[model samples]
Target: MANRFLSDLDPTTAWAKAAVDGKLFTCGELVRHAAECHLRDIRHGERRDRATPQRTSDNMQWIVNAVRSRTNCAGKILIEGASFSSSRNWVSNGQAAAFDRLYGPAGNIAFSPHSYYDADASGTDASCVAGAQNRLDPPLSWAAVGDREIFIGEQAGSGLDAVCQFVLPAAYAKLRDHPNCIGWTRWGGARRRGSTYAYRLDPSNYQTGEDTPQMKLLLRFLAQNP
Candidate 1:
């Protein structure tokens, strides 16, 4: 059986349906019971910092393997991290084994360790680089899959110049050697709603809108290097 791509109608509901249809489960009763047990454990954990019993059937790996064994899902299985989605942190403990057991060794799938940046406090390039490096440390396999040292976030008019010229390239220089470190993309191509931050990297104020000076610099670098 090939791997399946399963997401939620709602995750809990989807899990129940998948379990029943796959025949690993005979009825929704067991599935709902398992979910209730899991939620109770989660709620208990929030109230007291004590250990919670693990749900045997609803663990992501169990679902992944069951669906993979039964369905024709061939795409990469994007999993929510253990912190939010599962009782156990499978990736931290045994990522390779967990993924292999579920999806097999075809190497068609990749894992995305969700990482983000908050520029509200305003950080320097060095600080941003350090932060990204820290995030990349544990999820090293993402580098093999396709990770980059670029920050993709919202920026204002002048901010784009700052990011492209100094911030991004500096970070890229730090981590560009890794093959999976592809590149960065901005969160929004243009400013939505209303913002003082010029959406156009090169607006009328500048000669070229999208092809700003920073972009030229980037293109030149790519052409020269590549």
Candidate 2:
């Protein structure tokens, strides 16, 4: 998928020629792609194994190199080091140094970590764990120590309770106030028809155009920050 995406952005490729004719993305625009390197534990016929942190770091390095080599794209890659299975501290455990080596004086790459306030640190639940707002503190500190940029590429809470009202806002504010943190992308929007996902951001009706409680909370934060 990365190869295909990069090829499409290569100006010399046929796909790029066709896209340019159709007025697609220009080479000057800052293109960003997220590589969600989630640690996976696979089970096959009673055999169970999980991806090693070293392997994850190597894969992410490959993506960073690939993106950097595409000089024509003028892009950046958001490399994820944390997910449901692996907590935010995964970046500090040797992966940060590995990424620093790959980045190597370049400014186009940043660490992209997912944050959730649930009991398992997975966004699947609506209720937040205790003191969930401070969950990203360690990872943020690690990023600062490495002088690395961070982008929260995916984050969301399911309910309009404390998870959305308190925890989500506080966590987002941390990202906003942190100098090393660049930005964040909220998850749970743009669902397909009839989908029952908990974090869907659609309004009740197109005419009413009422923001969901979660959206309202996020928008309020944006207003204050802006």
Candidate 3:
């Protein structure tokens, strides 16, 4: 992350510690400034530590603005917000708020909520999303921000066919045809596993250097929907 994006968080560069020790900003600074202190590099899976889950989600807002100004490809970008631990139900609230903040500031960006496996039987589906929304349903910022901007990114297990037939369709129906939904993006474009991850939709299995049931399914859905 540091070699490329300069976002890596080192212990010495703690943004949160700086804020507390430097004594520069007040509680009002809590929401906007202070990079190392906010733990922008700290992800959702780390929420188990009890430091504070939603903190990075709120802090990422500034990072969003920075990305737009510096990166040329930020235009019409699909930004996946900080996500909760896909393996557990522990951090859904933090994920929800992060999703909102990531896409709230500019029309150039769209929300891509990462959907990895959870025990709930509804991972990436409407029901799962609803569960995540418990802390902030429909995101209080959605209406004023924009509609047709929500996209669901999925990480289906090796059962790509099942996800295509069941998860994708169910999720699409649940989203209620938002018109702007980007549908799904398979993690690692389907190659994350030596085949270990729960959603082992490893591209090597179905992608014969070209074809993938997942992509085909998503394309078909988009064709039909569009």
* TM-score of every prediction relative to native: 0.39, 0.70, 0.47
**Residue 130 shift from truth in candidate 1, angstroms:** 6.3
lDDT of 2: 0.61
lDDT of the candidates, in the order given: 0.39, 0.61, 0.44
User: What's the true lDDT of residue 47 in model 1?
Assistant: 49
lDDT of 2 by residue, 1-226 (tens): 2334235433334444444344455433212222122212211211232344455556667655655665545566677652232334445555555555555325577777777777777676777765676767876787888888888777777656754577777888888889999988888656452235656677746688977766777778889889
Best candidate per lDDT, number? 2
Superposed on all Cα atoms, the candidates' RMSDs to the truth, in angstroms, are: 10.9, 8.2, 9.6
Better of 2 and 3 by lDDT: 2
Q: In model 2, state the lDDT of residue 206.
A: 61
lDDT of 2 at 149: 83
* Model 1 residue 186 distance off true place after TM-score fit, in angstroms: 5.2
Off by over 4 Å in 1: 1-59, 82-107, 119-134, 141-165, 170-176, 180-186, 189-226
Candidate 3 residue-wise lDDT, 70-182, digit = tens: 45544665544433323132234465544544453456665555544323533432222323322222432352255536555444422354434555445545554445554
Model 3 pairs in collision: 14-36, 15-36, 15-37, 16-36, 16-37, 157-199, 190-203
